[model samples]
Target: MVGRKPERKSAPPTDVRAHVLASATRLFAARGFDGTSLQAIADEVGVAKPSVLHHFPSKEALRASVLDNMLAHWSEALPRLLLAATAGEGRFDALVGELISFFAADTDRAKLLVREAMDRPDEVRLLLTAQVRPWQTAISEYIRKGQRHDEHFADVDAEAYVLHVINLVIAGLAVFDTFRVLLPDASVAESRARYVTEIIRIAKSSLFAGPALSAEPRDPSLEGAPNRRNGTTR
Candidate 1:
């Protein structure tokens, strides 16, 4: 006797949502938030954009969902590193190292972050608000703790220090990768490795009344992380 036909299983709803967000991440990284159309995103995923809308109501929602998921992943992955830095385990230097590992692992998502900071629409601003705000707060408190423990400089300004370190990392990544066409000879891996190391060292350095360290040269990956801060504020 012939066997009965097997039934096909439907794709899980969770899987469908995951695919949509992954597609959105790639498109948003290459095409700016505004540049990326829902239709284009649908085409990338081989589903109707409306199918994407079923999971995420709008493009803004999609971007936000993708970003939130990325943030959640970092939170889950970095518990040990977080404890080391916040609990005064002398791994303050390693907190920024976490950022480097994250960047190297998913360059596009990291690029999307730089892009969000550069041209953030009102909705995308939440991404920075979520990441930068907590980082500034945590770094400030941690540095203050280090100062009390004599681990950091006595007179180091935590706010200024955090901002400077962020600028160094964000701007470092931007300039290296942004202008690659013009500086085609630069190596992103070699240069970014050095820049990340230097930035962490800078964060860990003492704040003597002496002169500051000279600004580091732009690395290949950082070419993309541009700053238009030439006598003009954003």
Candidate 2:
């Protein structure tokens, strides 16, 4: 007797939805939200327009879903890394490294965020209030806590420092495409590493207004086993 052929399994619904969201993120990042359409997202995902609609009813809905996912990841990841660090220097270095990796993973997020800040101020305002503000506030609080505990961090202005750090990270990654072209010899990975190194240097040298920090940079990998700190998983 002949055996039956193995049946091929279809992707799960969640997987399908995730693929669509990933396609939408790429499109929205490159084309801007208004420039990217539902049909385009469907085409990019190789799914029918109705299928895309089933996952995300409208362009705005899709954009919201994408932003929500990005915000959720950053909000959780940043806090976890910060809390995991045993000291202020460690926390600061981890923060810089993570920010570099986050934006470097996709330039679109950086571009989309900067564009939305200018083009759709109200949407940005809502995003900040709902997601970003809380994480940022926590980081600021951590900086302030360091200032209180360590003389070396005495003159650090938590608010200004955080804002400037964000601006530097986002701005660098946003324009990195051009930088890659300009320095064609450098692979994207090489460029990112170099940029992160420079960012770490700046943070260590300029951000603190106190005595000179140790000349050595902290470990870039920020390796640690899974652990808990301040009630957060780290």
Q: Give the number of the best model, judged by lDDT.
A: 2
Model 1: runs farther than 4 Å from truth?
1-14, 86-90, 118-135, 148-151, 179-187, 206-234
Residues 1-234, model 1: lDDT tens digits: 554333222444347678778878888877778899988776666666578899998777898887788778777767855765564333544566666566656767666777877776665566557667887887788678867877567788888887777666655665556644443335766455555655665665543222333354322332233111121111
Model 2 scores worst on lDDT over the 10 consecutive residues at 225-234
TM-scores for the candidates: 0.66, 0.72
Residue 42's lDDT in candidate 1: 69
Q: Find the candidate with the highest TM-score and give its number.
A: 2
> Ten residues in a row with the worst lDDT in model 1?
225-234
Instruction: Give the CA lDDT, 0 to 100, for residue 165 in model 1.
Output: 70
